[model samples]
Every structure is written in structure tokens, then in C-alpha cells.
Target: MAGVRAGFSTDLGGRLNVEPEVRAVVDATATVFTDLGATVDDACIDLLDAAEVFFTQRAYDFAAWYGPSLHARPESFRDFVAWNIEVGLGLTVDDLLSKDAARVRLAVAVDDFFTDHDALVTATSQVLPFDASWDYPRSINGVPQEDYLDWMRAATLISSTGCPAVSVPAGFARPAGVPDAPELPVGIQIIGAPGRDVEVLRVAHAVEAATGHGRRHPDL
Candidate 1:
């Protein structure tokens, strides 16, 4: 990460419901970049339309992969999976065209952001880890998560930009006011311009080395 110009953002312009501790970890990670001789600053790319583009493409992919099996035996797949496939199957030509156009706009914005900054950093996840048995978190910080996809907007939004991103272990934190709570792992996301996977990975490697968080494993 030495001499790399890095920009970081805690949230997507207030769109993400990030937990306090999660944001703290990402903030600290940016400091690590500064300490490693990288120029760090708070920067964010506009991704307001990311959800629409991501979900639409996701649904389309799901249908392409599982539509035949779903149609042959509706009960074969889980409810949520089937629902996503059905949504893809029902997409109109105009719907696809609109989302494609929005995706193009997002790509251009990301390209522009990278012109000034070599990489963008952010919280890998909006919230701390949850119980493994639950399908997904119902809410975060009192904000309702409408569906399985809601809680993962942080990563999904980045994905929609067509940039390369890597999530490296940043640190750990416990829930507030829960003295007995176990510390949950947090990650810092490093995003690079399109086709800049090598640069993103280099930054992530530096982060992992400096923090040493990736070396620690949890007890089962």
C-alpha cells in the first residue's frame, strides 16, 4: 500500500445501515493506509442506482442457471431461490434495457472516481456477524432489512460498478452494551478501477500483513 492514493467511505451516502463497530474498523483500516505511506482521504463514488442494477442482473443469472429445474419441480428449490428465479423469468425487455443503461452510468462514475484515487476503501459488511442458523438478519441498527439482499448492499453496490474489490480482515469488535458477547470479525473492502484486480489484491495483502487479523482463526 506504500505510496498508493487511497480513498475511503464508511457508507454509500447514507444508503447503507452500517453498525458503529463495523464503521470503526473500516476507519482504522484507512489509517493503516496512511501509516503505510499511502495518501488517504474520505472519498465515495455515487452508487444510488446500484441496487436496481445488481438485483436485476442477479435475478437474470439465477433464472438462467435454475429456471428449467424450477419449472420442472417447483418444490425442488427453496422459497427464496424460487422467488428470485421467477422474478428473472418475468423480467420484461424494457426492464433489462433500463437496468443496462443504469449500469453503464454507474461504470462511468466509478471510472471517474478512480481517476483521482487509485483505490477506494469501505466496510466490507454493514453489520457484525450474526447467528449462522438464521437465513439473514431481519434488521440492522433498528433499520428493517426487507429481504436477504438488503443487508449485503455494501458489497453488492461495489459489484455493480464492475470494479475489482477485495475484503481483508480488519479487526474485531463486540456488540455494544453486551459484556458477555463474543467479538465479531470485521473486514475492510479495497476496491480498484475496472481490470485493476492486481492493485486491489496488493493493497489487501498489505492490510492483512499490517493488521495480522487474517492470521487468527476462530474456535468452532
Candidate 2:
């Protein structure tokens, strides 16, 4: 991965195509957050709206191959591409313009955040729950649920800024509800503005040294 320039993937095909159980988990988590009065602020909602367009432009259709190639791709890949395309086409002219505007705002936000910093770091996962045997495109009831877009919500949101991000070991998390579950290793993602890959790596190294998480191994 070390080269003059490095590349990263975002929301593989723009939709994770995860099973319905994942969605149910997400919905249940949201309910808990809502009931606990941990509602998301309006600013965060706006950021999510902006992130959709930013990620689509910079990563999903970065090469402008979404149109013709979507038709020729395998059934698995084509569905997500077609879905993204359908969403894009459904937007009004004003909506399209707003998305473009959001892209510019997102770029500026990234620059402003990293203006005086080496990098920005955050927990890799907001929740500590896991299912080791969970399968992708999983079924719920009987039909498969293909839209698991929230899986990379944070990372892809940052990708809209064209910044570089690296995920390094942060430590383990105790399972919230499952008493028998093992302590799961989590990651700390370091994000830096565009062309600041070196700075991102440095920050990751510093976190590793401070936490010494990399030195620890999980029991099998």
C-alpha cells in the first residue's frame, strides 16, 4: 500500500448490501439512543445529508464509469450501482445543485478541521456489539435486505473531504449485552486532510505508542 499515492475504498459499491439483521440491530440501537435522549443534533443530520453527495461524487463515481459499466457488471455489483444511479436521477435540478454545493462545503469543513492539527481521530465503531457468524446480504423474515449504508457512515463521511484516514488498534471493548462474548479489539481511525497521509500515519503511531494496543493480542 506504500507508494507515491495510496488509494482507499469507501462503502464498497456505495451500499454494503448487508443482511436484514444488521438493519434490525441498527434500528434497535437507534431506538435505544432515542429513548435515552441521545438524539442527534441538526448539524449532524446536515452532515449526513452532505456526506451522501460527497461520497458519491468522490468515491462512488470518481472515475465517471457508473453509467455504462453498471449495465455490464455482475448482478451483485450492478444492483448497488443501479440503485445509486436511480437515486441520482430522481433528484431535481435544484437538488443536484444543492448536492454540488454540499460537496464544496464538505471540502472546506475538512480543511478547517485539520487547519492546525496533525490528524483527527475517532472510535472505529460507535457500538460494542458484534456477531461473529453474521453473514452479508442476510435474510430477515424471508427476503434479503441489501441496503446497509450505515456500516461505513463515519469513514465514508470523512472520505467526502478527500482526506486520508488510517485505522489502528486502539484496544478491546467489553460486550454490552452478551456476558459470554470475548473482549473485542477496536480501532482508532486517524484522519488527515488531502495529501497529509504522512501526518495521518504519524498520529496513528503516536496513538499506538500511547495505548500500546498493538502489543496486545486477543485470545482465540
Mark the 10 consecutive residues where model 2 has the least summed lDDT: 1-10
Question: Pick by TM-score: which candidate is best?
Answer: 1
Overall lDDT per candidate, in order of appearance: 0.87, 0.49
Q: What digit string (tens of lDDT, one per residue) describes model 1 on residues 5-119?
A: 9888878667789999898877777778888889988778888778889999999999999999998999899888898999999999998998999998888888788889999
Clashing residue pairs in all predictions, respectively, total 0, 1
Reference-based TM-score of each model: 0.94, 0.60
User: Tens digits of per-residue lDDT for model 2 on 1-220?
Assistant: 1111111211222333322323333223222223333322211212434555754564335234554555556464645556766555455667667778888776666555455444454434433435656433243334454454444455666666667888776556455455677766666455666897886776566546655668876765
| Model 1: CA > 4 A from native | 217-220
Question: What C-alpha lDDT, on a 0 to 100 scale, does residue 59 get in candidate 2?
Answer: 37
The candidate 1 region of ten consecutive residues with least summed lDDT is 211-220
In terms of lDDT, the best-performing candidate is 1
lDDT measured at residue 49 in model 2 versus the true structure, 0 to 100: 46
